[model samples]
Target: MRRVPGRPFEPEEYVLETNTILFRVFSTGGMVPRTVTDFNPGKGDRTRFAFFGDPTVPVLYAAESEEAAVCESILHDVPSGPGAVLYESFADRVCAPLAPTRDLSLVSLMGDGLFKLGTQARYVTGTMASQYTRTVRWAEAVHEAGFDGLVWMSNRRNTDRAFVFFGDRVEAGDLVALPGTGRIFAAGAGFDWLADYLTSLKIEILIP
Candidate 1:
């Protein structure tokens, strides 16, 4: 597999139906609203699919399931061990359920989709954080190819699919919040449920 796949190839497309509920974990303290479908402006840390040169081309990530959302976001950096996650990590974080108002056409990076692009899944999905600079170039290429977003198997949860939408292509009104479904991760039923879920994975959250 090449470090970076050639650009302008015919990418396999995946259509995300409007009925599919996507899960996203976000910080309540962040500039974007909890229930809004705003993209990250690339003002902070680098992400796997963020634009390398143009910070103006924003991105928003979501997962197919709640477990995938938590694993990909909140539990992303936590190591696989007892008490590996800190309680402070949960502060101000919340998960919102969202769905597209209309069908979204996205470039598929899984299965035969990889073959269409002349690359393997590992090169695109299994890359480490240090390789984001190289990985992001693929996103730029995909965006330039006129795709709305990219969809692939989640690195943290392979059984689930992860999605990244380009802000320049995907409008804010394209996605809508599911009414009364947002959950705050730090306290109450949200905390209790998450604690139980983490316990099943042999990860304990130490409260300071």
Candidate 2:
């Protein structure tokens, strides 16, 4: 694995089609807009691709698939084996499908993209939470280079891709929520679906 390059290099670009649907698992009735890109500079927890120290350069994250979105968000901190994921974790969370109103030019963080960046997958995409500070520098570099966003293999579910779009770069009308496809993971069809999905992974949802 090559060391993370200090100087910014030209990143490979990947174009996301307007037809590709992305899933974002987020909380409802929160301070931020429910289905819109989160422009709030994150306060407490550090995130993988969030631009650090720049309120103007906010970010929004999503996954290529619903299962990948759930794994990356709701189940992100749940430990493997015998660990119980609490029902409260899903209480206000919903997965919404959204699509770009136009094609997005994103920095590709997979395949030959990593090779060009002088780093490995684990360094950029698979690091633990504690290393987010280091990882975010890469994002800052990407933002500095004026890319629309980034695309990487999900650390939680590597088979699927995860995305982060720069709020400043993605215009207000860039993404639109699809109707009738949103699911609240706490109850009804959402809960039923989550339960079955968890059963397959041998994880239980504990209600308190």
Most lDDT-accurate candidate: 1
CA lDDT of each prediction against the hidden true structure: 0.84, 0.82
Clashes of each: 0, 0
Against the true structure, what is each candidate's TM-score?
0.93, 0.92
Report the lDDT tens digits of candidate 1 across residue range 16-91: 9986899998877755554447677776787888855444798899999989999888877776566568888877
The lDDT of model 2 is: 0.82
What is the Cα-based TM-score of model 2? 0.92
Candidate 2 colliding pairs: none
Worst 10 residues of 2 by lDDT: 35-44
Kindly list the per-residue Cα lDDT of model 2 for residues 7-98, writing each as its tens digit.
Answer: 64788899999968889998775666466445445644778776575454777889999999998988887775566788988899888888
Residue 180 displacement (Å), model 1? 1.7
